[model samples]
Target: MSQTSFQTPTNKIVLSISQLNQQSRNLLEGALSRIWVEGEISNFVRPSSGHMYLTLKDDQSQIRAAMFRGQNQGLSFTPKNGQLVQVRGKVSLYAPRGDYQLIIDHMEEAGEGALRREFEQLKQRLSEQGLFDPAHKKDLPDIPKHIGVITSPTGAAVRDILSVLKRRFPAAKVTLIPVAVQGDKAKTEIVHALDRADNFNQGQELPIELIILGRGGGSLEDLWAFNEEIVAQAIYRCKIPIVSAVGHEIDFTIADFVADLRAPTPSAAAELVSPDQQELQQRIQDFEQFFVSTIQTQLVQQQQKLTWLQKRLKHPGQRLRDHQQRLDELDSRLHNAIQNALQLKKTQLRASHTNLLRVTPTHRITQLKNQQNNLKHRLLLALQNSNQHAQQHISQLAQRMHAISPLATLARGYAIVSDPDKNIIRTSEQLQVGQLIETQLHQGHVVSEVKRIKKK
Candidate 1:
């Protein structure tokens, strides 16, 4: 080889392959530490070490990528060849091959990732508008009398809800408001169903007090209808209390946020709204036992009181017999007392008669009778003598009275004059002309009217 003299630059720095790769990696990480890339996954490999190796590509270009065990462990989905995904990682150069690759920290399916972003954006907007406010939530009825179920007619969700309702509370009437749970028409059908249910309750006596909007477990895309703003608005505007049971426990939707209650599953929604018959039966049994026990206790107490009363009570027949014996004794004593009183009275009467006889004065009574006869005879003679003297005095007085009496004057033809009033008139001056006057004779008097008056 011909020797050619060349001047080396003094300030130039040299680097080895490893050092260059290292520096490139550091610069890449510093620049693109956390970038999000979306592409189709190809040549995916998960070795026994649990680290995943894959090629991220698009129709125009492709890039090498890796996810270590620590980073890939938290991935919600498994990575496979030909699956489209979005990854978040830093750009780094591998030292072994000097190949620049993306170190993925997180990965998700591409469709789901877009859906998730949309979901978050809608959630944020609705939240700001107060659609997801707790204050807007309604209270679920304790025991709904009528329930409306909005779901596909043939889906597992309706079957599960109906089965749970029938088992837990058969009395709760179920009205199936069948609707498409997913697809382009799912949102419109659900909103219409909710409106129908709400309107039906308003116009019905047995109204739908509650509604269950539910579907079986599915991917976020399958459950997208529930996340629609129209469905959420319908749920919010519905007068009936709604329970959202849209997917598995981990899944969430806008309808769930706007609903009065969010149940993890369709079966759980049924359970929440209905009361358990078994618990009610148990309580009724407990009440029945308590009532029976109380009645039994009262009966025992009353029976004990009755027994005590029976022990103390005497027979009426025996009481009446004792009273009759006492009456007989009193009757005998009264009879003896009456007989003794009569005998004593008879003895007193006989003694009184004898004493009366002994004290009588018979001879004095005869002497008094003779003395009364002699006094009577003497009194007769004295009365006869008094009568003779009285008769003689009467004759003398009668003769003297006859000589000076007015009757004798009347017998000699002299009369007394009087006025009409029988008043004596001694002078003619006492009479008035044409007045009636009387003249007295021995046997009769005469009445005459004066013809004339003469003054003396």
Candidate 2:
């Protein structure tokens, strides 16, 4: 029981650097919750995965941040460096680098973002007012002859529009009204230009047909003049149809919605207003060819009718003679038909008379009379032969009877004897002594007594 000692157990807790980092990440993420941050953006990089990597910084501090594609895609405008932004996100540790970072869920521009919000609000308000309704919009002219343009006259937009108009329909004329396309003064210039076009079209013989309102592409601030409420109202009130072709196809302003139609570019608006001359030429040629073909067909049909009429012309006497000949031929055929029919009927009647004579009742009666005479003769001869045969047979029977008669035997001298009882005796043995007997001859009889009987 003497020496007991305590020693440390062999088991020990162990971890690699990666395992330590992962545990730290779990702890840090659990401790820090989601929060809002405001800072100017720097070192902003967008990768092929659509995820944005950036650093949010202030004068003294900075923090690494990430905004995934799904979150960044909701932003209306692209984010850039040095842009002040507000972000809402959760704190997270990027385990590979063992670095702490924030994962953003939402982002919005710090200052100019308010203007974008105001643009959407005004658009919604006017839409509810029905200013942008399709029923309220005027229809563009099918082929406008006199077009009016309201834009910066020296801009590229005017050059492209003029080129398209000349190429498509050189018959059309475009009147350009030069104006400032931006700044606070730009919206006023556009309004006055639209009113002036309206006033000019009222009493003119060849009125302005369509109006094109446009400018080149720019940032939202650069294009803000067209977004003014007064400009939208001016387009709405103009009697002449307006086609708003402002900026690139992707860029939109308030004027685009208020106009009668919106073209993606100024050149496209020109094409819409001008009709193709080549199409009209082809249609005219088709009509000419159709007219010529119809007339020719009618002439040929009339010529054929004239030829038929000439063939049908005839002399009255020749027609009458032809009719008389046909009538004579019909009469001859009718007479021949009647003769042939009468001949057939006579032949049928003679054959019928011969058949009637063969089956007459008088001839049948004569043959019956001959048969009756022949049968009568045969019956008389048969009766005579039968009577003769019956008489001879009766005579022969009488002779036979006469030969077998008892009197015939008596006549031959043979006598018959019997006891007095008249019983005949043919043997002596039949007689008894002292019996009286009688004898008969042909004409007499005798009585005697039996004296004795002899044995023999």
Candidate 3:
């Protein structure tokens, strides 16, 4: 029976290369959905699509990995060969090449993840303790006369800050308190630098009005000094306003939140502390003009007052002379008045004498009677002219009234027709057959009934 069954095997399982690869990919992906891998970066390549192709390797083993553009863009530091890194991704297989790889979603420097976790924890604690309270922050001087810089003396950050300060505001004196920016000594040095800058000058130099605590851009580990708790405390406790400018625009540390102000770069920090030269010049010019204008206005006001006072002022001698002149004028007026009165009396006496000689009482009475007759004739003529004017005015008024009178219009062979309700019939349509209406003529009115109507 076994020999009979061994004739042929038609049901043997077979698969094409593509099918095999696809099945293998499905199996691998399903089995290992997510995992964390740590190794040194190698064969790093970034294609035009921004997708990163790299190989992760340990001492004895290596694996291909891919970090797509979307996932890799959020990394703070640039990746390079030989750099140790940690990646979180899913296991995947490339069917076309039949190669297996890790599809990385997140990646960072190996120690950076732990540092960032610590950084966040510290930041949370500090925030809860109110170290970053706005009330604790001091306002930056409008124009800082003395600026203290805390950074490495040989680092690019100091150079950048000095250059900006020189260009923007040379008047401000910069005092450099050099400190190590990175490594084991960085945090302590930074804290000491902050303290020295805060308590600057025991009458040795100008006191620091503002402090610039900054460093150049770097990886999270390189900028760790600014993230230290002691450094944050120093910044918080410092009486002088501190401007933290560590790393690039995208990088943030605990110092940034605790300081009075945060600048994206060291140069930006310098610009923040120091006022612009051109702006100061412009302000000085404005103040100069205001002072000049104000002085000129006050001088003009005082001059006007002086002129008014001069007009009102009089000398004592001039006042006596004026009184003398006034007395003389009054004496002359009194003399003229007496002379005129005497002359008037003489004229009256002469007139009385002439009346006694040329005319009697009866003659005077006749002259008065003639004058009265003349006045009466004039009055009568005036009355006649006034009456004539009044009659003409009345005639003109009568003609004007008659011109616009309705009775006058009716007298011109036109009759006004109205309904029985006294409503004017403007058109024949207003009249209906058998409706009673009133017709107004020049002298009277007649009531009539509407007959056959005609309209034109």
Candidate 4:
């Protein structure tokens, strides 16, 4: 019965426009704040102010996203439409437009595979063009006097490099080629810096022997400018050797492959280009000490040898006296030897005279005649023996001569026919048709002519 009376259904919850907007903003901001979203980028736009506006959407949903100038400036690669990306940001309602959006703090390509694929493609193209060949790489100077640095002027990398160089070798000179290390203009600036550093060799200025290209530690995106193909090519084409120090120990880039050497950090690159001055000084001192000690030792040895030689040296007067004594002894011995030999010869002659007298007849003429007769008989026997031996030798010689002589063969019923002018015979090949010939025989030689030719 109480509901019988008709009344207009009414519910009152009054709110102002600012209050509505505030409530909507609070609800949306509270619900979707500080989120991580993975989606494909679409409708991407980069304004001249260096701000990025884009839509991130999955198959079922979509959201508007914005990366402001401050955040976008730090990015290495330009974000493109349809790129699979992950964004970290807060979801907030744009109060003025009355729309939900994401305020992105960070953005990255979705997976490592995509980045690796691009890397491989670029590497392949460069390799095919001979950019990555070992033969094309320049050799680093063994000792660099002047090293050029291409990096950010105000950075930890430069400081570390300078510290290391100054400590290792204070005398080495370093020149900085300052350039932007990040942002859109970083690659171009790096290329320009390299060119400028390389071209600095003019007139009387000493050319830079080495180059250190480096940057401080950062994420992959933060170091992506060094991975660009153009940067790699520039490094490869540099006539001077380049040491790449792009990031930390674990980081590597295309520049690392193209450079002549790679350092783990900027400090390491500086250390590579210079020798330790303190260590070198210490080594020089050691060598000097060694040399002095060696010289002293050698001098002592030579002095000992000289002392021995002084003791061995004899005075000229004493040497002459010794030679005179030896000569006198030799003269005495020679006189004794000659006297003994004369005595022995006289004794032998006496014995021989006695024997001769005993064998001789008393009459001088008869004895002489008997002696002559004996000598004549012996001489005749000797003469006969000599004649027989000579005959045997002559016969042997004749036999040997007969064996080798062609004349002997011809005497044994053979004749030699030779071409008169050539004096050649062994075969018919020496004769031509109608050629005059000389025939040699044991009896005589006859002139002849070739009437017919027979070869067999």
Give the residue spans of candidate 1 off by over 4 A. Answer: 1-110, 288-456
TM-score list, all predictions: 0.44, 0.46, 0.48, 0.46
Model 4, 311-394: lDDT tens digits are 989999999999999999999999999999999999999999988887765766787889999999999999999999999999
**Each model's C-alpha lDDT?**
0.90, 0.89, 0.90, 0.86
Q: Better model by TM-score, 1 or 3? A: 3
- Mind giving the per-residue lDDT tens digits that candidate 1 earns over 207-241? 99899999999999999999999988888898888
Instruction: Give the runs in model 4 whose Cα sits over 4 Å from its true position.
Output: 1-113, 128-130, 134-143, 202-206, 308-314, 317-456
Best by TM-score: 3
Q: What is candidate 4's CA lDDT for residue 357? A: 80
Superposing every Cα of model 4 onto the true structure, what RMSD results? Answer: 24.2
TM-score of 4: 0.46
Better of 1 and 4 by TM-score: 4
Report residue 61 deviation for candidate 3 (angstroms): 6.0
Candidate 3: regions farther than 4 A off = 1-110, 314-456
Q: Write the per-residue lDDT of candidate 3 for residues 1-456, one digit (tens) a residue.
A: 121212236875566677778889999989887899999999999989999999999999999999999998998778899988889998989998999999999987777756887899899999999998888888998988888999999999999999999999999888899999999999999998887775565565568888899999999999999999999998888888889999999999999999999999998998888889999999999999999999999999999999999998999999999999999999999999999999999999999998786688788888899999999999999999999999999999999999999888888999998887889999988878999999999888899887788888
Question: Per-residue lDDT for 332 in model 2?
Answer: 100
